[model samples]
Target: MAYWLFKTEPDAFSIDDLQQAPQQSTFWEGIRNYQARNFLRDDVQVGDQVFIYHSSCKIPAVVGIATVTKGAETDPHQFDLSSDYYDAKSSKDNPRWVGVTLCYQQHMPRPVTLKAIKADDAITELALKKAGRLSIMPVTDAEWTHICQLGGTE
Candidate 1:
């Protein structure tokens, strides 16, 4: 299965929040960027592995693991006028956004910080280093393996 990295603000939705959700699953919604929406809509698949990265915090890092429990569904928030993520451009007939449901797997004892990742020789070529701010991004198999090892999952 394809591997992915998904970033969320810890204050908005932390690893603990996912772990505590009913069935440990939640819709990965509110992605306003078209490219990020496209990844959720067209590239992600059920059973795909995900690196739960916490961004915009003191130490931006990958803190946990999750799996795609569902894929390629219209984001409900897009239709809710009261929601901050609501999109007037989106419609039932032609959605402009999409999201996936991710099921929590496990949290790392210590988060694998961006500094740590950058220092790792195995992940020098990771897109995260050069790209820097894509909310949803692909993770190479080798990078995934190295990260899991860093998180003490391997």
Candidate 2:
């Protein structure tokens, strides 16, 4: 299965939040970037592994692992008038946003801090280094294994 990294601000929706959700799962929504949206809509699939990375925190890091439990589906929030993620121009028949569902697997033995990733030469090709702002991005198997080792989870 393909690997991926999903970034979320800890204060907003941290790995702890996912771990504590009912059944330790949640619909990964609110992705507004078109490119990030496309990844969820097209590339992500059930059973794919996800690295839950905590961003905008004191020490941004890959904090844990999750498994994609559901594939792309129109984000229900896109049609909710009261939802902050609502899109006025998107129709139910032609949805503009999509989301996947992920269930918490396990916390990393130790968080692999962004600082540490940047210093690792073995991870030079990670998408996070090139497109640091994307909420969701693909991960290569080699990079995934290396990071898992760094986090003491492999």
Q: Clash totals for all models, in order?
A: 0, 0
Q: State, as a TM-score between 0 and 1, how close model 2 is to the true structure.
A: 0.97
> lDDT tens string, model 1, 1-154?
9999999999999999999999999999999998888888888999999999999999999999999999888888999999999999889998888889999999986789999987887786667787778899999999998888888896
- Candidate lDDT scores, in order, read 0.90, 0.94
Q: Which ten residues in a row have the lowest lDDT in candidate 2?
A: 124-133
Q: Residue-wise lDDT of candidate 2 within 8-70, one digit each (tens)?
A: 999999889999999999999899999999999989999999999999889999999999999
TM-scores for every candidate against the unseen true structure: 0.95, 0.97
On lDDT, the leading prediction is 2
True-structure lDDT of candidate 2: 0.94
**True-structure RMSD, every candidate:** 1.1, 0.9
Worst 10 residues of 1 by lDDT: 124-133
